[model samples]
Target chain A: MDNLSMQKLLWGVFWITSLAIGMVVAGRLWHMRLLADVSVRSRVQQSLQLVAKREGWLISDMSIRSVTPDAVIIEHRQHMRGRDPRVCVRIPLGTLEILPCTS
Target chain B: MLLRVLVFGLLQGFAVLLAELHRYLGVHTDEAKYLLNIPYPHPPLMRWILETTDGWQHQEIFWRIVFASLLTQGTWFVWDMGRKLHKDQRVTLCGLWLFSGALLLQAGTLFMPTITAIETLFLCWILQRIEFLKRWSALIPLLWLEMLFVAYQGILFAPLIFVALRQSGIAPWQRWSAFLIPIGLLALYTPTNPLTIVATGSVSGMSMGMPLEESVARVLKLWVIGGSMALSVLGLYGMVKSKQYPLVLTLMLVTAYIFVGFRSFYAILFTPLLIAGLLSAPKLLKSSAFLLALQIAAGTAIFLYVPFPEYSSARSVGDALRVAGVHGDILIAGSFGHEWQYLMPGPVKRYRPDFTNDAAAIVCLDRCVAIDRQAWQRFPQTTEEVWVKIRD
Candidate 1:
């Protein structure tokens, strides 16, 4: 590869990486409202809806077994929040309560 | 488009899964690079998941990669978009996407679950950039658009976008006019410990080898991409003169060819061109197949012949992982670390990603003497039954 091609390739890598990353950030910035509008309410309501779906037990087959200031244990399902660096909270199986499928 | 993704995505996932060789990955290749006391975590994550979850053995390591491999397909989408705009339709872009660059080296084959997913996510965003900027043109959407413009981090294909745009008569900076995106993305990224990013080429603090090797490898990688691009242009010229645009996307094949030929992480951004080539142009298929054959054969020979000192599969390290599984976790007493994780089932990774707390770490140790006491100490919970298995 000649110097120009090398330069182009390097520049190609640098700018492309930069642009894609920049756009991802831009998307987040632009979509922040949409995401928040979607994420927070949906998170809580989805959990509640999940609870409501259970048969007899208020605890569905999967429910949070323990809640602490630092962590919340939603049994059986591991909820991973955050990308790039993922922050994960593992929910043990025992904590989950499966609600019978309502026929 | 959705079916296109599914058809190609499943093929990619299967290819990567089949290409994966457990012995090479988990036992001794990667850790050998860093020449570190620490191990990589791909296999240990799988082992840990297996141990922690109990008998879910039927669930193969392939599934873990599959979950995240969608992002791999997403990348294929972006490469396609760029190739389309270039009006080149003379090559097999998709096959090249899977076979070239670092992909040819069998990357996703040996690592953790999210490894492929992260690559995929970055690519999908690149694909969306065209539509968002072209149609929406809304300032509010620009914020979302802004997230994508990292200078050199992800979506390593942005330069291609600019290149294609400039070629197509779009003014420079016009595509990115809505928002100054890099600023917003800064929020999402935890600042790289500049030293680590430079020295390690990653944020994780994994200990590695002589700086010289890493630098040489990186330099060679850049060279390969440059060379491939020239070959692609040569290939493009060969086809462009022939007047075959409708059934084959030349630029898509070009981008795909370069990525597959170079075999680097950067290939992730270019895979989408393959998808695009497949969707729009089918003429590049013959060329793509030939290039892929050449790349795979050469890549296999390169890896097989390259000799870095610490990478020894000769030792009975393979037996240890199996024993460790029986023993709950092996605690190598005197032995230093090897690529235990990559050699093992992937998708099972450490939070730190440096691999200290990984299962492979527990299996292989700086001190090989620790192996004798492993039963009593490491898996204190399973001593009774586990020890008998070890003895027998």
Candidate 2:
């Protein structure tokens, strides 16, 4: 192969490798949940606490179950006089409003 | 008619992206200062330009559009420069496509001096290529003044200007004398002289420089984000193979500067030469175009999905305060005060640790103030935590 053929081969290899990498990166970013990252868990917790404070709801305990683009799913026990009920609630990400448990 | 539609469609796409970015980001500290018209510690030209959008309903959006327009001009000039170098429209277009996907363009949506600096450098390159300086030698002083007033960083391009002058075959005395007028005029204007201010305070005030290992890491990160790894690798190969010593010199200067003080937007300076490198290999144009398209897609995906919350929380904090029915003067504790001051429609006072005030609300950003939990009602967001006074 001459120089032109050699350059063409290199370009082909680059195109394939870059596309593969690009696809993987996009997939990873798409699936990434802000709550799942251990580093940002504190922030998520603080947000949940802020929501609880704002709504004047006393919580026995809370743990993040999953996070969507717009909301975070969490299992929490709202403080009651004699009963603690663990329920999954969906809280909007930035707005931090805890809605009634879906299921 | 087809071409017109194509151009129109591309512009519409660009405008949408600009709007998305404008809505996504909160005003950064640097951008906030410029937005507030605080032109000190840097040249005033950028602030003056931004002042054009004052009183507009959507001033930030208008600012982004203005910057995007300037960067588009810079990108066009780079495409034209590629054409001059390669004499092949296809190769130049491919280079331009690769540049559009580069991290520089992705981050250029913000209001910053990087775009203006890039525009000045691109204009200089195009003028030098076309021998504009040689044709109109009298404009040399004017060009110098423009460079000086635009940004202090413009002094880096002196070597390129010198090269342009040499290529023009102008008399050495004439070329040397042209710089004198601009220098004397700049010295006369003490307040705006970027050099004097930079010399006295910038080094200590900026807290510039880091360990070599960190500096290298930062540059590598910028290289990957500014241009894709493939583009950079190919560009490096071409730079070595083409033996373009002047381009290499500029790269070294820029690298050294980045080592001293690195901002991600400094990546714009490397773009023209990187495109030049892409143009050097004619055989790879088709494959390179495909790779560039992939880069554009991937870059856009990351930019939209990833949440970088720094300096973007001010507007949200302001909105939350407004919703809480807190009005009149508010005290801001901690940094990014300018961003809050600009975002809020009401009077904003910076909170001092010693100062006592009867403000209804105090928003602490990135840093928390010592406040009695009983005295203030706290509303915390992801980044900014607002404390509204409850006690009289």
Candidate 3:
């Protein structure tokens, strides 16, 4: 084979090998992006529960409906130890509000 | 089936190599030129291909043959990966076709974040189908590595460390250490290449600018700069939270260019990686329709934002000249005055670059040049006015 032709063939082989490996690696990254893990979400939920108790407030309900980078939503009815919740607080996107201890 | 996949695997390597070669050979002109200078993200596998082909010089037949081989191999690699990942031969072929279509729309348009986004989404697909954690374990390191790169690129060190620790499922120290490897490597790499810091900074809305007093101009500046920061942050955050890597990468580009002074079109390079990842696994796509829609909508928004004809067309400059009014025969000069050629069917001549004073183009566009007062007097008959002038 001519020198140039042989060189092209060799380069092709090298290129093929590296990209193949990179693609496999790139593929796994995609996998990580897809699955949702419980580590952080669970911690947040647990903390909320603890706070709810200290305030003498009963969390009427708590659920993980949707989680995006902007905000996390937990739906709960507020109730003091003896009283039912008549008021609800909805936080705006990018805002944080501390719930009342009396709940 | 194994061979089909194996062949495609090889093509993926060449595709990345070729993408890099293209970056080496070409560059974007105008503002993006000085603003950022990063190596194409796919890592220029094609240059390696070209280098290896050195001995094949002087034989046209073989040269053509190798050229054709690379293209065919790249396409097949894409198709095969799709098939294997999807666990369906038909989907693999369709995915390949879809990828080819996207590449045809634009190839070797290598910006790292966009490509990472698409690849991330595709990888997520592969992970879902993998089912067996043991089989997938070998691949997770690469996933971590890319995120490490993203963290460094966007300066998201804290959250990246957080995610790596949370996902590692190991003891606290082990997880923390896993996160540190990337930082260690990143530090070694960044100083060794100070260019990336400057490049990333310019494209991250942290461009170097002189400090100034609080005034109307400063307030306007803050509004512009702050607004860009907010947009970039939002776009990146939205993609990450959605578990859509492609979208995340897309958002990165959106934020970087709009807020950080990079081009949105640069996101094209991610096309191949996206093709490889998404095509690899297809069935899970049904649930991902929202993400797909989001990407398209975002892309459309950018397109609607097309400011004018590109610089090369001269049409954009002609629009600028029209804004200047019938100041007809005088030679108008600016950094990118060649554009005035097409803009001014009237006698809109550009002043010589070196000869023209700094205030030279400020007469046309307010490009903050210290136009010498003497030079301004030279064109006494002419005056400066703010008009909806053309942009590069």
Candidate 4:
């Protein structure tokens, strides 16, 4: 075979391999995005509740105020400190964990 | 023609949207540096461009738009060059798709050297097409702009321009004069040795310490990360089959340049050339549409789902430092010192252990800071602590 034919064959193989890779990547990304959406809110709320409980506050008093792509803002009223004040905690989504609901 | 315009416009819009997403996530270090107008290692043109839109409100968004525009324009130029090189509209669109899909878009999301490198390539392509006599007049300003924007990497482009001139059938004197103009300007304006910048690996922190096997692996890893592994292999085969030796040589040189430096972001510099080579190969013509669609799909998926971590902690640290009444020369000690130096308002000093006493406050990475609760108070409302020195 001539050099040109060989080159053509190599490119043909590369394109097939690229298509396979692209399909796999695209499929994986789709799965991950689905998982993220399904679990992100519950995961964030559970973590916030755990932190509140650890701080000697009731889980019932704390609630998620807002959730953005990068952060989750939680508003909670602390009654144990003898003064009822609403405290807002902003946790980066990247740092948020999926803690068990111990309460 | 309208279809072409619409398609390109949509691609540009998608590119801009991806850039906007990046900006919203957080201010990257380079973006922060440009925002603060800090003297960076690269040329000042990018900073100056960002400075024009500087204001207190939504400045990051403004900078993102500027960056997006640069990438969009660069993509358009690639498409334009593709059209000039190949008759097939599919090939042109595929080239554009390949560019928009690659890590080049991610690099474009920030104010980095990658955008300027792309712009330099665009200008070189334009210069290559211009008539010799006409190019002489155009060459001087183009070279100056390239130098002013890209610094030492701009000099690597000289051989490409030289090849372009040689192919133009211009007389030896004319070609020499055309080339000499830029060299003269570079000598007059640039103080340091351009070659020294490359030798030192300061361009992209690429140096020559790793083993050859490791270096090749690093390059391959970068190629994969950039989402161009298969395209690059195809492009390489295409370049060889087409016998475009100059381009092949230049691409090899650039790959080596990035390989030695080993900066992943620098992989963007050769993307346009790779795409061009791929588009030019006749054998790949049938696959162009499939490749283009797959790339666009992959690009869109990555843009929507991939989480680009923004260096937002720098801003929080800066704000905390100010609120804590820390003033004067602040010391930043960490891997992210360059970012802290840029974000900090006042005269900032990067940490050296000896100069720790000179700072009013020390912004050390959590791991790097010594465990001393008595002498330092950690600032609240920040992921990273800003340790203000206790005043006696």
Candidate 3 lDDT, tens digit per residue, B252-338?
Answer: 443434334434343332343334334333443443434444444443443344232233423444445445453333334344332
Q: Is candidate 1 or 4 superior in TM-score?
A: 4
The digit string of per-residue lDDT tens for model 2 on B1-392 reads 99646754665456557656755666765566565554444455566666565556677777676565555445455555555443454444444434443433444355444554565446445554645544544444445556655555655656655566566555777566555544544443433222234343654334355566877887876665555555666665666677766656766776777667676666666655565555555444546456666656655654555345455577877777767777655666654435665666455555644332466777675465577677778775524667777856
TM-scores of chain A in all candidate models: 0.33, 0.46, 0.33, 0.44
Each model's lDDT: 0.35, 0.56, 0.37, 0.56
Q: What is the DockQ of each candidate?
A: 0.05, 0.01, 0.01, 0.01
**Runs off by more than 4 Å, candidate 4:** A1-103, B1-9, B25-40, B48-59, B82-107, B124-141, B167-171, B184-206, B224-227, B297-312, B319-329, B333-335, B350-361, B366-377, B388-392
Which stretch of 10 consecutive residues in model 1 chain B shows the poorest summed lDDT?
B35-44
lDDT, residue B336, candidate 3: 38
C-alpha RMSD of each candidate structure in angstroms: 15.9, 21.0, 23.4, 21.4
True contacts kept of 2: 0.00
| TM, every model | 0.40, 0.64, 0.34, 0.63
Span of 10 residues, lowest total lDDT, candidate 4 chain B:
B189-198
Distance from true position, residue B331, model 4, in Å? 3.6
Candidate 2, residue B276: lDDT: 58
lDDT of 4 at B86: 47
Q: How many clashes (backbone N, Cα, C below 3 Å) per candidate?
A: 95, 1, 35, 1
